[model samples]
Target: MVRSTNSAVRQDAAPAVSERQQSRVAKRAAAAKPAVKSEPIELPQDIDSSTAFQLIAASIFRQVGANEGAVRSANPQGVHQMRIGLRRMRAAISVFAQLVDDPETTRLKQELRWLTGRLGPARDLHLLALRLRRARGAAPERQKRLQVVETMRNEALATAIAALATDRYRKLQTDVWAWIEAGDWLGGAARRQVPRRARDFADAVLAKRARKIARRARELEALDVEGRHQLRIAAKKLYYAMGFFESLYDGRKSRERMADYQRKVKELLDHLGALNDLAVQQQLTGSLTPVVRQSDGLAVIAPSRHERTKTERLLKSAGRAGRELADAKSFWD
Candidate 1:
């Protein structure tokens, strides 16, 4: 009798969480209120890279799990938190990519990307609906559009909920936890690098990512939509990277410098985020049928003059923020 490869893989995989246990966890999550913000992870200054990575990954996993019940209930903030958690987890993986370059890590990343994709639409639609509600006018047409957005958001949320309940998701969670604890990356050639001091690792990663952002910032105004979007992503990754090492800089002076660095990066991210939101709003608005005028039969869907002005203002603000970030001193220095 020959053993099957599938059976071999199954034997090696982490034990799946039972459905009954999952139900109890879900109930606990549902009863708890979602955290308003991500709490900072505090790692010791002398911790090894592998240990630091594990702590960061564990914090992110907990965040993702904490929001599941709220997501099932269609809570907008829950959706946002869960999405951010996933994004941060992906960034963390990238930061530690060199030490975790195993096949299992790649497979886990693919699964995470799939889960993030499932949750994206709902978050985007929810933001769009909020924007529409906050607009100056309360026209019936606007209300109708808002209703359509809500319907789409509900559907998206339903899909996200279904995704959370899937066996694939359960296995993904189990495997991720297993990987964080004792993945293959911890053994073999990578083991040598994993034990390196996190501060040294932090300094190298921060300086490298910062350089990329600085290079992009130099021509901020000249960047087109796609370029700006890429800049936003780089800034976001750098921000998450910074958070991972915040606890390593614990001295009063170091803390202050780190705080300033974080503030500058965050400012840049905020401006870029606003710009992205404007683009997304434009895309969402364009997808809807415009309110038509009876007399001239013209489409009334173009962005309002106010919106055009806001866009111009946001562009200027984003450019300024980018420049400021470029000039700011690196805390890791």
Candidate 2:
């Protein structure tokens, strides 16, 4: 088991307030404070794999923290940004998994997953509610359904806030910060490889992710919903990985290649994400079934007739974007 050096240091400090009281105070403070915007992460050119991993992990952790206040207050952008931070952190861990494979790393990943799960429903519902609100000239029944969706979104947000205010969340933050600074991974036999140049590690990681995306692209038409979803995830990871290492490849030619590669990935993600939103919208609106039936005698929230056509269009666009990504020259090369 990996221990947190920070936890050990805190053990020697005198406690002024009970842990429960401190938690309440912290929650109040977070809710009352304004959220800080996340700053860009700039990596040093001479960074080693371990140092680069620590920098990336720590920056994302801070970004998540900076949005906690806004999330507590139910700010939509804050929730979106905080969720993005969590995803980026997850991608960072995955990218550096070989260097940081330890018991604590596994535990940390689990904790992060739990927090992300808590925030997921809130974000999803919030987006759905926003879209519904923007539907001008909606029927009276549709408006009522929108009210119910907003209520569900609020409930989800409350749950997410409660999760963030828990001791578990506090402990997770402390443990992750400590692990990033001084985890068992830093002292084990695997540490021998930690000093390798980040550029070389990044090249291998990017190539591996790109290959997966390319293979998936070849079968884009044949892929089922789940397969396409997995491909989207792979593409997202590659996108995040590319962003993390962007500063490393900084010459004019390198910058152009990176920009082009990033544009292709972003294009692919946009189309896939739109398709995902349609699917999620259906599921979310379907979840309002009981309420809808009780209030309006409707079977379920019906999708627009054009939804199929829209999905087909998105699929074609995603296929085109995927082909472009597969054919793009790797900036890391």
Candidate 3:
């Protein structure tokens, strides 16, 4: 187990940001009309494997377009939504990598990566500011400086907006759409290799993912933190895969079966998410304390004295959740 040097005490020292404040940050980035010309793409009810990939990619692409207006306005939610759209697009591209291995798909993925990078600083700073907001317990004088946090957010937003205005960003929209609509992968040898059966593909992919999660869960008693993080990633991938193939579950019984599967998967995923958040904060908590504490004499909160205890509890919960997921029935079959 690779232990994080940043203790829970350090994490506790970060001030609490209110939900209202976070919402305001998202709203402050001024908006204008969407710059992209792409129309919204809708996914059909039933789909084959390749069609499913194309539909997901297209829908996410449409999300980027729809959010562009608010994003241009500098809405934080717009940035968040567009960022999600990028993430989902990237996931689809990865899942379907064998099918879409041409130069164009590679280039588009790279461009999306670039945009994601550009958006990351603003998003991270926004989160830091919100997350570092002091909870009710601390003295008002010791709270993290909301003003300074907002200033940093503005600066990061400027960079994001500038990147969005570039010719490359504009071209990425058109190019990626063209690739999705008429990729060489749609026909010939590629099509022959990649089957059109969404149901079969979903079963194989999800079953493999579930097996990994099950294997990891059963062995959690012996694994380290990094080893468990891999489990969380697997869970997330399986969750996303389930979402993509959900429409294929056609009957009332099938849909009910899917609903139960979704609920169980969500529970497992949430627990996994909690573990990942703690692990990330463990590395970041102590390093961030000084900067958050010193900005214009604002005092940061004290690190939680009980951090070690909390970590132990969280790990235990993750273990239980992992076991539960491993034991759950297959939704894909």
Q: Best candidate, TM-score-wise?
A: 2
- What digit string (tens of lDDT, one per residue) describes model 2 on residues 1-333? 111212221222223334454355345535555555556778899988888988988888999998888788766567778888899989998988889888989999999987887777767777788888887687887788887776566556666677788999999989999999989888772555643888889989998889888988766767888888888888899988887888899799989999998999999999989988878777777767876788778666467768889999999988888888888887776
* Pairs that clash in candidate 2: none
lDDT of 3: 0.65
Which candidate has the top score in lDDT? 2
Q: What is the TM-score of each candidate against the true structure?
A: 0.85, 0.87, 0.77
Residue-by-residue lDDT tens digits, candidate 3, 255-287:
787787777778776766666655554444445
Count of backbone collisions within predicted model 2: 0
* lDDT minimum window of 10 residues, candidate 2: 1-10
Give the C-alpha lDDT of model 1.
Answer: 0.77
Q: Give the poorly placed runs of model 2, Cα more than 4 Å off.
A: 1-38, 189-195
State in Å the error of residue 188, model 3.
4.7
Better of 1 and 3 by lDDT: 1
lDDT of 1 by residue, 188-258 (tens): 53445543889999988998899999988867888988898888888899999988888898778878878
Clashing residue pairs in candidate 1 are: none
- CA lDDT of every candidate: 0.77, 0.78, 0.65
